[model samples]
Target chain A: MDIPSYQDMLAAHERIRPHIRLTPVLQSDHLNALSGARLFFKCENLQEPGAFKVRGATNAVFSLDRDRAAAGVATHSSGNHALCLSYAAGLRGIPCNVVMPHTAPEAKKDAVRRYGGTITECEPSTSSREETFARVQARTGSEFVHPYNDPRVIAGQGTCAKELIEQTGGLDIVTAPIGGGGMISGTCLTLAKLAPDTQVIAAEPEQADDAYRSFKAGQLIADDAPQTVADGLKVPLKDLTWHFVSNHVSDILTVSEQEIVDAMRLGWKYLRLVIEPSSAVPLAAILKNAERFKDKRVGVIITGGNVDLDRLPWTEGA
Target chain B: MDIPSYQDMLAAHERIRPHIRLTPVLQSDHLNALSGARLFFKCENLQEPGAFKVRGATNAVFSLDRDRAAAGVATHSSGNHALCLSYAAGLRGIPCNVVMPHTAPEAKKDAVRRYGGTITECEPSTSSREETFARVQARTGSEFVHPYNDPRVIAGQGTCAKELIEQTGGLDIVTAPIGGGGMISGTCLTLAKLAPDTQVIAAEPEQADDAYRSFKAGQLIADDAPQTVADGLKVPLKDLTWHFVSNHVSDILTVSEQEIVDAMRLGWKYLRLVIEPSSAVPLAAILKNAERFKDKRVGVIITGGNVDLDRLPWTEGA
Candidate 1:
């Protein structure tokens, strides 16, 4: 797999600038006091499609040539990426075909449809998703845009960190929740060139600690159907994402489900911002391991604000 | 009761500028489409104490003379006012004594204590609250700071509308939920002088419609014990607040309990904001009486965000 350079990230920023919001950077004195760190939250939750996924999706959709753009884009995601790609496709007036799990949340399905994406439901498995996506892509002759692994997508995600660096005037460290490592890879890509002294960290749920395990083992470790309340961080890292993670990440931290829920509640209560469980992973890591971040200025990326309010993770039986 | 002038609001803004945040004005394309009007939400939820109450509290705390300042401040409130007063007192390094109902939410009491205020619990009634507050004031020799009736607080609340007018380049109408009429009076105070052509509106819960009744009757009408899910709006208006509401408000609207919950949910879902039920009242009015605000540039003051997460109104049996 080819690696995207800093120039590509810069170009992606220019391409997607008009299409996405420059989400605000928020601070909480209470959160800072609790964690013993000066934390600046990059609120990607305020993104147009309600997640950082819009950066990469918009970049991919807009980077296409007219012929490919007319053919449209296709992706297999039951999460924010599906909805975000659909949003970008709608913005560009192109067709977006999404392959989602049959058991996906109704809210997620509704969001994709609302964004004008055509959805094809598949069995809830990697094999079924890939098989279904392949058939749909072939039938529609649409370009396949991997959720996080593609070079264009990684370059696009890097724009978030670029904004973070600019917004905070550099930081001692920057952290983002790692799912398939799209956002973390983008952070690594930007920090590696723009602010090499700044440490890049990845946070994940302990229930789905494949990224942490992979970092410690010095090899990519894939998890099979790991369960976690942070539903967005259940996927394992791919080669393109692992390339950045293994090489550039200073550390991979893990937090328990209870910690994630507590952090999510704290973000809502103290920060007064609507953030999802997946977005809470970084703060969970910071609170659980405050010694490492003590007195340091940390930039924590809030990845999204897309959760089923009816079934919050902290609710009984959720 | 002496009425607060625009000059008082200007001075209040200058005094509180260094302490309070200049909250952002957020626009929602989807919300505009839903309501058929351009809405600019002044995000007071992002204020230091997680509500707009901090503006008035800080203004009052800072406005005190040295002798009175040394004596500190006291108030009787069951919601955001108690916590905001505490926050302001903590900022100014002064003692803050609060008399709150014993039945007030534990979270609110904890917040007040967290901000270094002394809480004196009273029975959940106007007579009990007043009797307890009188004793606390006498014992502590603190300056009595009425939650909404004071001129300093009214001036302080007016700063929010001043900021809103400046941020949105002169809105056609301004609206806020009327509790003791603190926020609405402030909106009236500012708009009446700064943009006299702009209409100032007040929203209230139908279950707690004392303000609506008073506006219609052209006289004060206090509810003995009104009930509403919006705990912040249960209080009746005072003479000073009534002065502004009566002289400047163009209309007073009331929404049902279900409408408040629906508006709160819609704000959380679409605007990606964590606003209290009281703050949602203005949006509820806009949604219900669309023709009144349709095609107009409206500034909606989101009064506060201090809701308990575990007991969200939308949750089953909540």
Candidate 2:
């Protein structure tokens, strides 16, 4: 497989510019005081489909050739990717087929349907998801867009850091939650070329620390459905994402479940942003290791805001 | 009471500029689709004390001369005003004494304390508030800053609309939730001079519709103790606030408790904003009257983000 170059990311930015929002970068003096760091929150929670996934989804959907685009697109995601892919496909007047686990939150499924995606549910397992996805793609003849593994998607995700560099001028450090290493790889991709001095850090839930383990062990590590409140970070890294991670990432930090919940509440309380558990991991890392991030100009990617409101992680019995 | 002129608002803006945030104006396409109106949210929820009340509090605190400023400031509020006043006074290195009903949320009281305000708790009654405020004022020789009825405060709140008009170029209509009528009066004060053609609408909770009733009757109608999920809107209109309401407000609209809760959820879900029940009222009004707002540009003041997370209005059995 060919590695995605900086030029590919630049192209993805141009292609998805009209289709995506240049979400605001917010700063909180209160958060700064608490963390002892100057934090710039890239609020992709404000994205159209309420996550950064739309960047990749839009890039993939819009990059397709006219004839192939006519066949539509397919992806298997339990959350934001499915919703965003549907949104992007709907924007281009194409069909989007989403394969999801039956146990996935109803709110996510409803959002996918709302954005004109057809849902094909499978049993909640990796094998089931892949098998169902293959059958669905074969039956529909849709172009397969892997959530975090595709070069096009990674290039698209890289645009977020590209904007962050331009928006904040430059940063001492950049941090994002690593699920399948999509956003972190994108951050690495952009910072590697544009701002080589900037350190790229990946944060992950301790409950699902595949990326952290993988980075430390110097090899790709796969987790089999690790449970975490940060549902978006449950997936492990692929070879394409692993390549960027191993080459450019500065460090991988892990935070406990309680820390993630605390950070999520802090985002809502102090930053006045509605962010999901996955989005809070970077802040949780900062809180856990204030010494590492102290006094640094840190760009933290708020990955998404697509939690089921009825089942908020901090709620009683949740 | 002296009427607050647009000039006062201009002066207030200049006075408070260094102390307060010029919060971003956010737009949600999902909300626009749902309400059938192009909405520009003036996000005062991002203000220092997490509310637009800081605008008024800062104005009132900073406007005082050296002699009066040294004596400090005092107010009786069960909500955002106390916390914001404390914030303003802290910024100026002065003491702020707050007289709050014991029934006020512990979260609010803690916020006031956190900002260096000394809290004096009273029985949860209007009469108790007045008596306690008088005693505190006499003892401390502090200048009394009325929450919503003071001209300086009205002028301060008006700056939000001033920024909104500039931010959105010019909105066809402006909406704010009416409590003691501070924010609406501020909108009326600014729009009456700056954007006279733009209609100014006041939204109220149906359960505590004193503002709506008072508007139609052309007389101030006080509700002794009105119950509402929007705790901020329970206060009655005073002469200073009523002056602006009666003269400049185009209409008063009210929404049910359920509508307020639903709108709050919609804000959290779609706008990705952490807004309080009171802040949701303007959007709730828009939802309740789609015909009136359809296809028009509307500016909605997101008043505050000070809700108790442990007891969110929509929590199970809340």
**Maximum-DockQ candidate:** 2
Which lDDT value does model 2 have at B235? 83
Error of 1 at A136 (Å): 1.5
Every model's TM-score: 0.97, 0.98
Report the TM-score of chain B alone for all candidates. Answer: 0.98, 0.98
DockQ of candidate 1 (2 decimals): 0.69
lDDT of 2 at A24: 80
Which is the leading candidate under lDDT? 2
lDDT (C-alpha) at residue B109 in model 1: 85
Per-residue C-alpha lDDT of model 2 across residues B1-318, encoded as one tens digit per residue? 899899999999999999999888888888999999999999988886899999999999999999999999999986899999999999999999999988787778888998999999988767788899999999999999999999999999999999999989999999999999999999999998899999999999999998899999999988866788898887889999999999999999999999999999999989888899999999999999999999999999999998787878888485
What is candidate 1's lDDT per residue for A1-318, written digit by digit as tens? 999999999999999999898888888889999999999999888886789999999999999999989999999985799999999999999999999988776767888999999999998767788899999998999999999999999999999999999988999999999999999999999999999999998999999999999999999999866788787887789999999999999999999999999999999999888898999999999999999999999999999988788887777674
Off by over 4 Å in 1: none
